[model samples]
Target: MSVNSRSDREREHFNALATDLGSVWWGSITKAGQLRLDERAKLAIRYGGLSPGKVVLEPGAGNAEFTKRLATSGATIVGVEISPNQVAIANERLIEFPKAKVVVGDINKLDFPDGTFDAIVGNAVLHHFDLITALPEMLRVLKPGGSFFFTEPNMLNPQIAVEKNIKFIGRALQNSPDETAFFRWQIDSILKRNGFSRIWVKPFDFLHPGVPDSLIPFFQKFSHFLSNIPVIKEIGGSLQIYAQR
Candidate 1:
């Protein structure tokens, strides 16, 4: 599909989610899901090198969950989302966060000038776009030495592989028409080719948000243990991407 059509489809899909499910479509409404968001937000803030005086760009800020959390660090955050409905929800979430705001825009055609941001952070957002085309825009917006952190689906994982490759499964899972998962090396190589340095893409996150609330802590510990193992670590459900420009 052409990029324009793909973006239109993304807008439609996410607008439906914003209208029908509000912020629950991506599984952040439950207790375990909330914990997962908290962990992802913490990782992004810590590893993305966000600070009080810095300016950060958060692309595809659906519902602004991460944007709200990022704002707590005192950094100025500009959140871009393609879906107007989703942007409305995101704006609601950031009502009290004067330092952050969500606007409807395309990541591939960002409106900012070069070297405008100190860092970029995203959560499961990059895979929705064509990485080869989108990474350059990300690189263009970052100041020298600026870094980025993103958590995306791991194509190596069994469920993610199936979800990405199988049409029926992906539709049932509410995936957008053009969204796909990525291998760690795929993203690492793309970042390298785009002139990013200090790149590190590691498979991580085994705890599913659907796990029972009572079992969440146990699974969290198990995930931590599994991360330390060699081969087993490669099959985690998501990839943690950290890189500098």
Candidate 2:
């Protein structure tokens, strides 16, 4: 097969995995894992400068889990997703939150007017996109003084490194060839190049998939402690990035 055909097929592979993502992905996470997700959303929303009545855009909003959490802050959120399947799921999940809505749309081709959003946020979605193309579009739609915040896998993590670099494991984890984890320097450079300022990149997350529920608090404390030490923190699970447009 030609290179382009292979690439297209791989793209389809990931998208197919995405359709059933919430059912398989979110449902399988442990309670500690769930709490960590909620914490990340809280931190991202705060750093993104979201406030009551402010408008925020969340791209790649699968199931609206993060979006629903952000809505707890009393902000108006629009979750844009490419899969109609996920959109429906997000809508259903967010039905009780009148302030949040999910719409079917591509992040690269956002239909909203320029400078229309107070902020843009996402969780585990940034790496699925080409920053070169997506960041500029995000900047265009964001109002001046608006912020962009999200959490992504830290490429420096040992387990993440193994998953991404190993072919069979990566595929099993549904990591397509097009997907990538982000390093702090890379995120810093991209945001700067895209005309963003006040960029903040923090690495956090210590609980693992295999850790027992009772040990989660102990692990969480240890993890946060490790993330504070220089060089050691690079191996933490996720990188939270906040930048002003």
Candidate 3:
């Protein structure tokens, strides 16, 4: 299938899953799962240097798990989710924050006006779309000097691929377009083309081979510690990038 077709199918798959599951795996679990999510959210916020009274836009907010935390920063938070069910869940999750708005929409065709937000954030979402088309929209919606922060699975991590392949084989999945090592490079190029400056990339959750889960707290912690080391930090489980328009 073409990229466009695959994207549509993936979106449909997620929408159905969101409707049936009520919430995505990211927010429905507890204990170490919640901790992993919270840690990543905190890291993104810290990296973005989010402040009070700013207008923050989160595109592709699955279940709005991070949206709730973003609201606590005293920013006016708006989340655009492609899945209506996920948007509904996000609304409930963020109902206390009157300034927060969760809308069901496509990120590639966002409805916001140009230069509308102080910061744009996305977590584990960009790889789902063709960056060539989607990234320019991300840059266009940001105000001058505004920041864009995103966290994506690190395809460069050898262990991650191995695990994904294992799951693929066990599930009889074939021809799945797993994230590639070139994703970071492609994104960096797109950011540069879109006039974003001071791009910074950091790898996080290095020690563990797979997703940060209950069975790997010690390993995750060890990896987190190693991430601070100069050389080891260059390669991690996820690649986080921050760029200013």
Candidate 4:
């Protein structure tokens, strides 16, 4: 299998957002954005298995917002973003961090040689393409025993469902033209087919945007509360995963 190419619409959408997250209604560091970042940090620590001296590759580094944070792990992180504009921004923003470097590259056609990295990671990125093909390409590049981890939105969530499934509504919500969320079973099947073992999946989050920061602490607890509820667990917010090649 080979890396998939980006669609023209997908390239345009991301390039525009790369100019600035604020250009998109949903990508900015609003209250919800902060919450999302916090969750990503927690997921990385608990599942990423990143450690000092390990070399990690982050595809779709997106202006390095999460990439900069990943640097805190004391790992050598090479962030490869496909959008040149976003890569420029990431380089500028990451200047202060010695452990991190951002470059413009495609996730489907990664530039590295086989087994060059200890791990491969992402955040809200895998849903952009048909993972059935992409995962094999990734496995080919990753070292034996190298891990893959990331968090992605759950399509079953009401807000996400409408935004992604409805054409006009998705545009209004700034859902990327080429992106789609995933379900647990679907993802598990994809990983298993790609030869990933020891797969771990956890669902969490319930809070949406517009919640004031002052109330975030309260709502965060409430979000986890709802995540534990039977059927509600599947539609809360995002799915966190960790798997090895």
Candidate 5:
């Protein structure tokens, strides 16, 4: 699909979700969902090395769910989203955060000047675009040594493999028409080709948001254990990516 068409689809897909589900568009409105969101934000902060004065870029900042967390660190946050509806919701969620703002724009063609950000961080956003076309723009906006940290769906995971590969399943699960999951190696090579350095792509996360609240404590521990097992670790539900430009 052309970039324009895919962008259109993304806008429509997310706009509808924002109108219908608010922050719940990404995860259930439950303790499990909150846990997942908390974990991702913590990792993003630690891995992205965010600080009070840092300027961070968050692409696909739907409803500002993650952006709000990033803002709490006192970093200047500029969130970019394609859907105006989602942007509006994000803006509201970030109203008290003077350091954070959400703008409607395409990530593949960011409006920022060169070296505009100290780091780029996001959750489940990259797979929505063609990295060959998107990464160059991301690399262009980052300072020479700026880092990137993201949590992306792992294609090796059984559930993700099926959901992404089967059109009906993906649609039912609310996936944007063109969005897909990724293998760690694919992202590693793409980052390298796009001139990013210090790249690291590791598979992690097995705590599903659907797990019952009663079982969460035990499941969280078990999930951590599963994520550390050598080859078995490759099938984790998410890939933690870190790279520097």
Candidate 6:
């Protein structure tokens, strides 16, 4: 399928998912599913030096759960979501937050002005786009010295590749496409080309897919330990990157 058609289908899928969540507590249950994920995300943000009172933009703020958490830190939060239904649901979910806003738009053609935010953060969002277009756009909206934080599935990891291939093959058999692979070197080069410095990459979620939910906390601790080890850090299930523009 062409990128345009695939993007359209993805928008429809996201809309349906958002509507389903809206009908059932507007993502409260879905947010619960994100607890483990959020811990990882927060750890990345902390490592990236995210500060209170800064203006932050979250591109592809899927259920806006992370945006809500950022808002609670007294930061001004702006979330850009590709799905209109998701934007509406995020707005409703974050209504009580005085420092939060949501916009329905694509990150590749972000409508925000240059130097509009102090930091840009996204999780599990970039791999959805053609990276050549998306990475430059992300840099364009960031101010000089602004931080960029992103987390993506690490295709370089053996376990991640196996789990992802299983999902990809299943989707392909159903005539659906799953664009979730990563090119680690290409991503690093793109960040460098965009004039971002102080680049740091860290691996995460080493024990996620194979572990049971009840053991997530213990596994997360083990994953953190493994990520801190020299030889194994680059081979985890996810990669979290932080850079300064």
The predicted structure with the larger lDDT, 2 or 3, is 2
lDDT of 5 by residue, 15-122 (tens): 999888875254546788778788889999998888899999999898888899888888999999999998998898888999999999998899999999999999
Give the TM-score (vs. native) of candidate 5. Answer: 0.97
Candidate 5 stretches greater than 4 Å from native = 24-28
**Count of clashes, each model:** 0, 0, 1, 0, 0, 0
Q: Tell me model 1's lDDT, rounded to 2 decimals.
A: 0.89
Q: Which regions of candidate 4 are displaced past 4 Å?
A: 1-5, 20-28
lDDT of each: 0.89, 0.80, 0.71, 0.78, 0.90, 0.70
Regions of candidate 3 where Cα sits further than 4 Å from its true position: 1-7, 26-30, 163-183, 207-217
- Candidate 1 lDDT tens digits, 1-245: 67788888999999998888987255677777788778898999899888898999999998897789889888999999999998988898898989999999998799999999999998889999877668899999999999899999999999999989998999888888888988989888888888999999999888887899999989999998997789998999989999998
TM-score of 2: 0.90
Which parts of model 6 are misplaced by more than 4 Å? Answer: 1-3, 20-33, 163-178, 207-213
Task: Report the backbone clash tally of model 5.
Answer: 0
RMSD (Cα, Å) of model 6: 3.7
Ten-residue segment with the worst summed lDDT in candidate 1? 23-32
Rank by lDDT, highest first. Answer: 5, 1, 2, 4, 3, 6
Q: Compose the digit string of candidate 3's lDDT tens values, residues 112-142.
A: 8999988988677776666766778878888
Query: Model 1: C-alpha RMSD to truth?
Result: 1.1
Error of 6 at 225 (Å): 1.9
Candidate 6 structure quality by residue, lDDT tens digits, 1-245:
55567567657767876775552122124333366457655764675456677888888786676677767667788888778887887888898997888888876678878888888886666766766667777788888988888887788888557656787653432212445656567667778886788887766657654355678678768877987898677787778877888
Candidate 2, residue 216: the lDDT equals 82
Find the number of clashing residue pairs for candidate 3.
1
Question: Per-residue lDDT tens digits of candidate 4, residues 174-211?
Answer: 77776788888878888998899999777788877667
Candidate 3 — which pairs collide? 207-223
1-245 per-residue lDDT for model 2 (tens digits)? 34344335444553575565553253236787677777888887788877897999998786677788889888899988766666677788898999999898767668999999999998888887766677888999999999899988998998888887787888777676667788889889989988999998988777775678889889888987998999888889889998887
- Model 4 steric clash total: 0
